[model samples]
Target: MDDLSKMGIDAARLPGWLRFVVVIVIVALAAGASLAAYRWYARPVTLSIAVGSLDGDAPRIVSALASRLAVNNAPVRLKLVETGGPIESAAAFSSGKTDLAVVRGDVGDLSQAQAIVVLTEAVALLVAPPGSAISDIAGL
Candidate 1:
């Protein structure tokens, strides 16, 4: 006990079999922790995606895709960002505020943007009341 105290080890009061069992349990715990660490490093990557609103469809679509990626344990996961409109979303993407963004081609300067996925084509429509004689919006 004096010799053990000199060496700074405190296992003197433990029985042989109890010490062996303790050592085995410690080894098992270490192995389990190592396994967990490996699993965490081996899991999928996460990415951020920005989408706009006021059309309201883009954010929902991106969110659904993110959910699907998580459900399948995909190699990549998307984090969605919601900006108010297409121009704001494009600005966010161009300014390096986000990793990915859904922006309209004509909305803002897209020199910094690249193609990832092209979803659909959309057209803007304007409606006028009947017998109003409003041929053009600028003339109204």
Candidate 2:
């Protein structure tokens, strides 16, 4: 009591019950703030992805990936936006309809697109008749 008074706390002026209530209120407020912060930090971020393919494989693949991410509790999640094909997917991306997209390199407007991965590789082959004079690419 003497030390509190010397420190100018004036503990005697506050009722014991009132002091307990004040302490409880402070603790409750701190707990609430901690809960709010945890919820904010643990929230998952979802990004919309445009996917399409002639055989409908793109959408299926992306959907599976999204499901796996959710199941694994990943920090980043994907939302699939199905389109007709690569052209439509690219258009959706270009128009800001989707945050990401699975599109072919030669399709639509890709000026603002950045390559993240190569899904597939294609080789172009030029063949001629066996008796043709064209033996090489330059001879054609």
Candidate 3:
């Protein structure tokens, strides 16, 4: 009997099952790479963010978030429209001018538009004279 390795064409050289597994692995890897490339090169999503006037923290935070998104290849185009506070935000939302807003909770009733994401707290600075004292809530 001739040895399998000594034969010119030998089934023992590489098992049929092993060949099937290698082909499957190559196909899976190709599919995964195609999916990743599609996700990376997709068009940037457009998001309209309604914020207060170009003043302080709100604008700064929005800018930072936009920048970070851009860096991550998920570009965000911010369309900042000036408004008073939450009330204005609600109105802008109702009119469909903005997709999101930085608004105050105390801006009266918000029974119109649905809240997407709520930002908890915002720091406000009160600058007064050296000898000034805030006796009551009204003073602030």
Candidate 4:
């Protein structure tokens, strides 16, 4: 204590009320820093998504997903970017304008893209009367 006072940095010399206030200030600063760190860690990550469709189904689906994520307080959120169609969406994704995109498998350049989900599938079927001459696709 004597050495600290000689160095002009003695805590023991502080008045009782002043020392209490100093301790309170230090604790408050520590608590504020902890809160700031927690907020930064808990913040959600937002990703931009490019979507396009002639019938508007792609945009609608993506919007619904974004809304659901927000409502569920998900850690990852989406921001929808509506392009004209699959080609435009693919272009946006390929050009690095968006982080994710909804595009058809056969549309545009997809060499750098990987399919995450199959949204739709198509199958062909033909029906004819039992006595009909149509037995194959060429018979029609």
Report clash pairs, candidate 3: none
Q: What is the C-alpha RMSD, rounded to one decimal, of candidate 4?
A: 2.7
Q: In model 1, which residue pairs have backbone atoms overlapping below 3 Å?
A: none
Sort by TM-score, top down from the best: 4, 2, 1, 3
Tens-digit lDDT track of model 2 for 1-140: 48988888787698999999999999999999999999999999999999999998888889999999999999999998988888999999999999999998899998898998787768999989779899788997
Winner of 3 and 4 under lDDT: 4
Residue 68 lDDT in candidate 1: 96
Question: After best superposition, candidate 4 residue 126: deviation in angstroms?
Answer: 3.9
lDDT of 4 at 104: 82
Using TM-score as the measure, which candidate wins? 4
In model 4, the Cα lDDT at residue 39 comes to 97
Residue 140, candidate 4: Cα error in Å is 6.5
Q: What is the lDDT of residue 64 in candidate 3?
A: 85
Candidate 1 residues 9-103, lDDT tens each? 77766789998999999999999999999999988888777788786988998999999999998989998988988888888888888888887
The better-scoring model by lDDT among 2 and 3 is 2
Alpha carbon deviation, residue 78, candidate 3 (Å)? 3.8
What are the C-alpha RMSDs, in order, of all predicted structures?
7.8, 4.6, 10.1, 2.7
* Each model's lDDT: 0.86, 0.92, 0.72, 0.92
lDDT of 3 by residue, 9-127 (tens): 56666888998999999999999999999988776777787776435677777778777887787655655665765567667766777777777655544556566677676687777
Model 3: residues with Cα > 4 Å off, grouped in runs: 1-41, 53-55, 75-77, 84-86, 121-140
